[model samples]
Target chain A: MIETDQLTRCYGHLTAVDALSIRVEPGQVLGLLGPNGAGKSTAMRMIAGFLIPTSGTARVCGYDVAREPLKAKRALGYLPEGAPSYGEMTVREFLQFIVRMRGLKADAAYRRFDEVVQRLQLEDVLGLCIDTLSKGLRRRVGLAQAILHDPPVLMLDEPTDGLDPNQKHAVRQLIDTMARERTILISTHLLEEVHALCNRVVIIARGKLLADATPAELEQRSRYHGAVSFSAPGSGMSQEMLGRLPQVASIEVDPLDGRITVFPKVGERILEPVERLLREQGLEVSEIQLERGRLDEVFRQITTQETDGARDAVAGVNA
Target chain B: MSPIAAVMRRELRSYFVTPVAYVFLVIFLVLAGTLTFYAGDFYEREQADLQPFFVMHPWLYLILVPAITMRMWAEEAKGGTLELLLTLPLTLWQAMLGKFLAAWLFIGLALGLTFPIWITVDYLGAPDNGVIAAGYLGSWLMAGTFIAIGACLSALTRSQVVAFILTALVCVLLILAGQPQVLDFFQGALPRKLVHAIAHLSMLQHFDAISRGVLDVRDLLYFLISMIGWLIAGVLLLDLKRTR
Candidate 1:
């Protein structure tokens, strides 16, 4: 498990990670979501023992990162931001070096190296110098190094930044296979990644965590009322007057076309009235649909700090 | 032992892979050999001691040691491998000591390749082998001082060029402090005790004394203290940087 008690890192006048207190349990994949410079990297570095927190402390398993650094470091496998593997070494040599540095021995060591190499699909570049590999291949090498020792906690910063779609799927699958045995904390800004891999998400902005919740809960909050949109032909009066009905909560019109989005109050169904109004107005609608709130929608709402404008993490709590 | 030896072995092997180190070793041997034969008048006098070659080592080390130590930490930081290294099980002091010792040994190997001079001098005349041994011991000790200070400076910057230049400037000051001409001015202008104390801090006095077949306890202690002291300072600098 990874836990922090009001952890923060300050550099000169800027606060990188501001009093972040969180708990990441074992066998769970926690996605740390934030924009660039959201203090995600700083928090991960502190947990990895690469950067010391200016205040508070981070613990890995039960060991404090600062006070029991070796034990903390030993419990964690960190792929730092930018994926720093030795450029001078070949893939095989670098993996071997990490194995030794972590104090693993013999059969167990070779097997561990083999497992990471296979999982990361790094066999093709095993003989090439790490610096000579492509960005995607080098990322695999970095992943290989991080998992070489099989530490209980894996702190991966942008683990799939340079990977192709196929490679990305494979890596996500790899993480899924291993999540049952380790606590993985991945810091990425992408919403789909959280939807695809993580069960829980923590949204941080400008050095502070804004929200943390499951993807489904976030999506549920995006809907303030029922919205059902579809194509219909109006034969009578205007569609705008139809919205004047008591059942309508909101009507967001797409000005260029006749497309309209209608939201009613909680537990209210405005679709039947809207459908009847569209028929009476004699209006032809090509397409109409409700906004399906995914993790991306929730992320947008949080990054813009538009709490009132949308819902997810906070909306769920209020509900 | 495992940690130190592990780091030291890799550092020593690195010299063979890079052109700069190979070139350094060849040039060092050539210069040491040429100085022994041409400057010392070895062919004419059949000298027994290695004083001529040893006398020039302090100057040689001023340039060579920095070249060897400059990339120790600076390269690691610049390449972003310092993060990988710092996160390893080894402590900063252990890594620093290992790298410094490895560089020292590489320099020692380059110096040892000039063994033909010892053979030539011993073959021609009855040279005091003990003095030749002492000269080597002193030269190695002197190189230790340069390596220690250079390693400390290496940890101060990410640019190897900056580390090299800083170490070279500090080395020049040490070399000049004990010069006869500098002493003449200091004798007239400064207090005797202060002047002598400053001179004693230099590598020259001890290196020169040891090169001349003397086993001075004070000089040996000076080299030991300065070498270890500078290394300790390097560890402290690393800790301070890490905390900040």
Candidate 2:
């Protein structure tokens, strides 16, 4: 388990992280979502015991990070931002150094070493120096070192920041397999990654927690939730006709592609009514989708509101 | 293995992988040989001891020890591995000590490789082998002091060049503290007791005493205490930087 209470860090007058409290229970993959410079990496560093917070506390497996750093650090594995490692050492040597630093014994270290190497598909490049590897392979080596000890909690900062699509899929799959037994916290700006891997999501902006909810709950806050969209070529569809339905709230047409999207009234279903209307009009729709919710839209809405809110507060003070 | 040992092994191995170790070793050996023979006038002095060799260590180490230790923490900070190493289940002291020991050992290996001088003296005259061994021990101890100073300064910045320059500047001040020129300049301005205390703080004074075949407990303690003091300062600096 990982828990932090009111963890804050400040540089001079600028507060990088502010009163951020979060909890990640066992077997839960928590996605920390934020835009650039949102203090995601700073928060992770404090939790990992690399930086001391200006106030409050972080704990891993019941050990307070500041009070019992060794115990807390031993119980957690952190892949720092940019996945930094010794570039001069070979992948095998660097991993071996990590295993040794973890104080694993001879036989157990060997077993864990082989298991992590094989799991990360790092056996082929074990002898290659980290500096010579491509960005994707270097990230794999960083991941291998972080998981070499098999700690119960893992924190990865931008784990897939520079990987190709195939490598991203492979890494996501690995995290999926490991998610069953470990409490993993991954920070990313990629909304698709939150949907693909996270069971719980926390959004932060300007170093403060903006919203904490599951992926579906966050999507529900979006305007696109429960909306039906379809494309029809050269078909006559009137906004007034769709507005006549009791379940319909509004309609939007794509100026470029002529794709029409019908939004539902609050807590109402409009897919059936929209289908009936399309059939009655003898309109042939090419493709259709009922969006559970658009996460990107929700993410933008939540984060931008926080920024605007801060801007207004500054304006209020100025006035 | 313990965390300190693990860190030390990795650090020592990394030195070999880069050209820093080879370059430092070659330069140190060549300088020591040249200074002992030509600069110290060993052939003309007809000395039966390695005084010519031992006397040049403080000056030689002022430039070279920083070269070995400048990258100790500066590279880690620049490369972002400082976060990786600090987050491991080890205290800052362990990492600092491990890096110091590795650099000190590398210097010791370079010092050891100069045994051909000892053989040359032995072949030429009946030299005092016991005194030569004491000189070697004293030289190694003094190198430890320089390594500690360099490592501490390395932790103060992310640029190796800055670390190297700062360490060299500090080492020069410490080595010159006991020189007659500095002391004479200070004698008229400062009180006698303060000048005496400043001389005592000079690494050159203590090292000179030990290298002259006198194994004073005070001289050994001076090196040990200074090494520990500088290492503690380094650990504190690392902690201070973390919060910054």
Candidate 3:
């Protein structure tokens, strides 16, 4: 388990991370969602015992990071941003070095080494220098080193930031498999990654936590949740007609494709009534489905609102 | 394995993996041989003692030791591997000590490879092997001091060129501190006691003493203290960077 209490870091006068307090229980995969420069990396560095926190402290597996750094670090696996490794070393040499540094006994080290190599499909590149590997392969090597000791807590910063779709899927699959038995914290700006891997999401912007909830709960905050959207090629479905329904709260039309969306009032189900109206109108609907909610929309709304609120406060102060 | 030993093994292996080890060895051997025979006039001196060879080590190390230590921390910082290494389950001092020991042993290897010169000297005349051994120990200790200084400065920046230049500049000053002309220039302006203290700080003074077969405890202590001082400074600088 990972826990932080009022953890804060300041750069001169600017508070990069502001009194952040969070806890991740065992078997939870927490996704730290934030914009660029949102202090996700800074927070992880503190927890990993790489950077000293300005105030408060972090604990990994019941070890306080600041007071018991080696103990805390021993219980954690951290992959710094950009997955830096000694480029001159072959994959085998680098892994061997890590195994030694981690103090794994020879027999168990060899066993774990072989298992990780096979799991990551790294047998083909074991002898190749890390400098010669592609970005995706480098990322895999970085992951391999982190898990070499099989620590209880793992922290990865933007693990899939620069990968292709297929590579992203593969990495997510690896994380999903590992999530069952470990407490993992990964930071990314990619919203889909949250749904795909994270059991809990913490969203922050400008170094401040704005929301912390499960993926489903976050999606529910979006206005599109429970709303039905349909694309009709030539039907004249007026917005006023849909808005007049007792269950409907508002209607939106996509000008580009003429797809209409009808939002239901709170705790109301309008799918049946909306479908009935579409059938009665004999509309040639090409496609229709209910949105679980758009994560991108929620992300944007939550982040922008904070900035806008700050701007308004500044304006009020100036006025 | 101990963490320090593990780090040292990896660092030493990396030196061999790249052309750094071979290139440095060749350059060091060629330069040491050329300077001893040509500049020191080993043949004309008719001295079986490796006095000529030992005298050139300070100048040789001034140029070469920095070459080895310049990338010690600079490359790690530049390539972003410093973060990866530090986050591992090891202390900062362990990593620093590991890197320093690796570089020291590597230089020791280069010094050891000069045994052909020893064989040549022995074949030529009856030279005191005990004095030669002392010279070798002093030279290796001096190289350790140079490496510690260079490694400390390397931690101050991410640029290898900057680290090399700064280390060379500082080493040159330390080498010149005991020169007669330099001391004379400061003789009138500074007090006699202060001048004497400054001269004592010169690496050449202690190195010359040891190379001459006088293995004074003070001379050995000087080299040990200088290496320790520089390494401690390096650890502090790394910790400062983390807080900053």
Evaluated with DockQ, which candidate comes out highest? 2
Using TM-score as the measure, what is the rank order of every candidate, best first? 2, 3, 1
Better-scoring candidate (DockQ), 1 or 3: 3
| Candidate 1 chain B lDDT trough over 10 residues, lowest sum | B1-10
Task: Tell me each candidate's TM-score.
Answer: 0.89, 0.99, 0.98
Q: Write the per-residue lDDT of candidate 2 for residues A1-319, one digit (tens) a residue.
A: 9999999999999899999999999999999999999999999999999999999999998999999999999999999999999999999999999998999988999999999999889999999999999999989888998898998999999999899999999999999999998999999999999989999999998899999999999999988999999988766645567789999998888998878888999999889988888788887888878979899988888889999998999999999
TM-score of candidate 2 relative to the true fold: 0.99
Candidate 2 — which pairs collide?
Answer: none
C-alpha lDDT of all candidate models, in order: 0.82, 0.93, 0.93
Error of 2 at B180 (Å): 1.0
A263-306: candidate 3 lDDT, tens digit per residue: 99998888899888888778777778988999999999998998
Error of 2 at B18 (Å): 0.5
> Where is model 2 more than 4 Å wrong at Cα?
none
